[model samples]
Target: MSPQPVLLPRRHWLAGSGAALAAAALARTGPAAAAGETPAPGAAGATKPLPAYAAWKDPSSLIVHSSNTIETRRSAFGTGVITPFGQLYVRNNLPAPDASILAERDAWQISIEGVKNPRQLTLGELKRMGIETTAMVLQCSGNGRSYFPDKPGGTPWQVGAAGCVLWSGVPVRWVVDALGGVDPGMAYLTGTGGEKLPDGIDPKSVIVERSVPASAMADAMLAWEMNGVPIPLAHGGPLRLVVPGYTGVNSVKYVKRLAFTARESDARIMTHGYRLSPPGGKGDPSQPSVQEMSVKSWINGPGTDGTRLKAADVQIHGVAFGGMHAVAKVEVSLDAGKTWQLARLAGPDLGRFAWRQFVFAARLPAGQFTLASRATDAVGNVQPEQRMENAGGYNNTSWADHAVKVSVA
Candidate 1:
């Protein structure tokens, strides 16, 4: 993660460059893939609102997909170091805990069991272990989920179902180490959250339990704060497990129970949801679940589609990130990939899991043009020109992904 600047109050950061604010997210929609009753307490009318986001985002500009999820646009690389708490994207499998309960996180208990030394820790106890900060990108497993050719299944996410945040928490390793080390036989760290389904829905089926590989526990965090402030209910306040580099699903929210086990959790979420299909094949239940994200990048601006092409020189910038490696560099294509130019990467390396910001500049004579971008990670993975189509549109990293057009005056 990048070095954190001096901490400031929420209003200060909100009014400033938005670097110090804490956050809260989603995509657009069709027939509404998400089911179950509305989760937000005091939800206005038929639509559930994320109050934390309502504090910052212009409601008029948001794309409400389901009762809960919302999406943000790209137009950044020109703004804050961390996505403001109010502007961070949100996605929830279950309804959030009421504000009254979240306001008293210290009263909530996290049941940590199944390890050699099973125990319980309140939110206050976890916070007393000292503070560390990490700035990493947190993205929904289906951040790029847009129904192109397939029938829309879930939230219609664009690029906005993702955000970079500065999290404050205690390393999960510390907690595990305090418990006398992990058993070599343990293979998974399964977690369950507080969001439960409305009455009548089989509790077992709708539970948002997920189990991540135990290996992630090494760098994982039990975070309670965002951008240095107490996290809001909308952003998984009280506590959330954050696993960097992996998709957002690994970072479970409203964590109430966690268990170390010898195998993956059998919870429907882990057993049936978010699995990746064989290349070019529809999602097969027998296939393994997805973990690291594929390398990807896209142009953020120049026309309304991307910014309007101007007669004068235009500056272009966007974000690039995927999986474990930091972005090495981004390449820009103007003539439909017939040619390419390297764009300058900005700033020093943040964290390996943090997204790399990039920029390019040029003057184009009046005409209509197509602009596209691709990124290569330090690990040698290059954003492909075409991504294999997935039934769920989980990782939509295709060559034409985010390609934009503008007519120059």
Candidate 2:
């Protein structure tokens, strides 16, 4: 069993102070810090203030990593399927465009290329083309970085940097069909963000452009609204690309360019970043790009604040999700995986990409116990016992690393 963490008052954890303390501890022990690797210039730390657009988030429900980076607290997820806007995490690759841009939201234009008749489409014009909505899990590429033993160079996120959300937009397929279809040789779909570029730097070096498999366009969309409202600027307003079953970065925020390419984008972000590298290795074009997420699940209720529970009936509940498939079932292990019991899957099945809530009830006597959850997807892919080691600590779906340790009195 994993060693117990130091216990703290519930109030501290709930107020977000203890969450900061936990993040600081993880940062100090990361492999980069241990090997004396210097932090990149201007790299944000755990103490930066939240950005103006994120001021509405509940401080008690998030761990602020930087002005543009914040994560939801696992406990704050509660039992809801649709994460409340105030509790959803915020992650921005570049500073969001000024809120003043919302003044002419309908007039925002997106250039479409690689089609028989390439043209620009205004947000208002696209809205008149077709409308569709989908619910999917929007997760960061390094969501489980803290669980990596080698420790990566990004935010030490755990299970909170992800959430299921509803996006409404014009389907990419419909747009392409109306525009006379994509070029015959196109093999990739690329989206470019609209954030203003910093001066004196090669725009390609820092632009947010990602090229995904052309097949993704089947479920891809140019989303103008999130959770039923005009997409908030903080989360990418005016327009954003929504790719279901893929990592959040692929859903370009403030998207301004949509194109079908014969090859992937040449942007540095596409050619050099978000790649899966060997342990202690540097990312490069040879490495695989972060795309679709994998099957994962973890306990959320009975928070891991080291609190003691009563020696009676206890209800254990959490969430499970399949990256591209539906979760078949969730199993609960109260004795650190020694014995398992099938848990009741609660709530409505939102779809294959949406998470399913799982609940289990158990009676216990005074003792120390560890709780864990295992999930299997429709294709027979089971959540693993351990995570694969990698330079960026990207995909982590291990049951052991995410298990909750608690005491029953």
Candidate 3:
């Protein structure tokens, strides 16, 4: 666990303030913000403006469930090539980072340890080593927990806790490689977000630290920039780990440490949480850990379940992704799963980890209808009709398995 002292870079840390925000706000005072408008670009660091979702090309009408737990409704899933940064789902386990901290991105530091020669590096230094960008989906392990058959007692997320983001940062392996290469014997490469918990919570129980398999280091990045901007503090700013194809928790926002070790952190998150327990059972360590997501798809538009509309040629569109590969094909079903129609894939293939957007259209007479979709990945993985039940609701991709009914007047 020996880590060298942090070597701060030449960049000066910026300070944020309210007056600066007010000045910036005045310029963008459109009809939208009646007064005291949210700050636009060039606002001081202190101005933590709410991101523009409904305000900027927002279609799904995303919901805010606390600053940290917002949900992206099903209609928004296929709205665009990239989920708007402001409208992206939020699932912060801890309090969201404040503006001051995010403004200090230049000073962000991560301590690397446990290897033969450990060292500490600032965000500036990490960028010098190597910078790569990959667009991928960051999904909460329990995104659809609310629909679990057994019923879990945690956040009732309904497939809204996931989004595709373009993340850019130094390869995590660069850190491991810098630390004199990894020792093969080590099983897990542990890391942690630097956020502190409240006084009453037991420090040991807090999952400030969690980990990914060492093999995953090859695809992981210690990202400081997301979606072409400095990573917002709300997401995981200053720095965060972006492990493509893994659950969002594995991304570990506000990251500050990296340790390659044989033992998993005793933190509740690593052991008790994120487990795939048996149906109706509490988390069981013996069961497999929640890692890659399963094949899944969601019909995003033409309104949500039970949506009523006049008879017309309704366009049905959605998004789908594979656990470990690009989505090869996506199919939609109107009369439940009795018949399926291949939907057209659209836009660019950001990467295997990024979901593929699909669209289908049909002219409907006045009547009641149901819609459903299934996806097949490049690796031959097919979306299942029924989700595998687990008490924790870790990977509820099966939420898309059922038919959603809509009314056509």
Candidate 4:
């Protein structure tokens, strides 16, 4: 069948104003000492306080992982924008205060409200709460934002706007139950982080407060461990919120408080930002933007050096993901953008929220070439080349197929 034809208006805001508020909050909480900086270390050049939506602007901080042994043209994927030694994505909630300011052990506390007997728990108390582990892919809603056809109003994001890691922590329901179960009429559960925003930015803007229905709280988790250890301070140490299948914006980081209420929260951070135009333009003004991740795939191997391969057998590999559903198919193309074929898939075991690995092996002919891949879900949702326009920076549904230059020896 021919490629699906969809018209995505050109004017959409990829990042939400709430994201800016979160960034501004981090800047005001005081500079996170340079020690925890991940990717680039101490090489400070263009390191400026990021706007709420500009989380992935720092290039040096991106985490790079490649399976191919090629060293000349390195292939890797990052969680977000590259910062000093790690990648940055504008998180909807504020970051935790630096260890230097709060001291890892004594700096944070978790408060549970709206229960019959609310209580405050420290990180140590939380550790004893029977922690469960899950491997999840934490991605910004605007991960491949730059790919969006140039438009006004959106956060600037490159390909490295997402990351996958094993997360470990206490389930949100566990904490709520420990506080003597929730009361009736509770429809929203709000989470608060410990970080503060900069001087000029509005505190109302920086403090991220979002609420989910009590029914959804059963699945919400408070993660403290990542990839087998306590989550790094830079990555929301002590505690963070993990709401699987929802856009990263709803997964608040640096979690400090949880409140159950009968009414939906009026936090501007949750209501006004990260929202997409509802299907058929009938938007739900009351519902928050907590939809499943859209299907997406990326080409990450055989960079500049692939150009030297002779017209022989070649291995093309990349990654694919569909928020909560199984990736039913992944198609690849080699002739610029003409014909297409299926690629081998691996890794549905990583859970519904993780990215799957895929590969296509074919005999390439001696000539210049272009390559691309598109992923489809079991729900019949094929990845789109673009998305419908909106004001916030929410570009989750756009296709990320890439064209790389290669030559045969």
Q: Highest lDDT: which candidate?
A: 2
In candidate 4, how many Å is residue 234 off? 2.0
Determine which window of 10 residues in candidate 3 has minimal summed lDDT.
Answer: 5-14
- Tens-place lDDT per residue, model 3, 30-90, is 2111122222112132122234422342223344544456666565454465665655667
Candidate 2: list runs displaced more than 4 Å. Answer: 1-48
Ranking by lDDT: 2, 3, 1, 4
Q: How does each model score on TM-score?
A: 0.84, 0.88, 0.83, 0.72
TM-score between candidate 3 and the true structure? 0.83
Question: What number of clashing residue pairs does each candidate have, in the order they appear?
Answer: 12, 0, 2, 34
Better of 1 and 3 by TM-score: 1
- Whole-model lDDT, candidate 3? 0.69
Error of 1 at 112 (Å): 1.4
Off by over 4 Å in 3: 1-60, 399-402
Task: Give the alpha carbon lDDT tens digit for every residue of 1-409 in model 2.
Answer: 2112122233443365433432332232111111212222233554455678888666666667887778776666767666767778888889988898789999999999999999999999999997766667899988878878766788788787898776778889999999999999999999999999999999999999999999999878899977667888988998999888899999999999999999999999999889988988988999999998888999976735445678988789899988878888999999999999999999766678778889999886788888999999888899999997889888888999888777888
The C-alpha local distance difference test score for the whole of candidate 4 amounts to 0.57
Q: Any residue pairs clashing in model 2, and if so which?
A: none
Backbone clashes in candidate 2 total 0
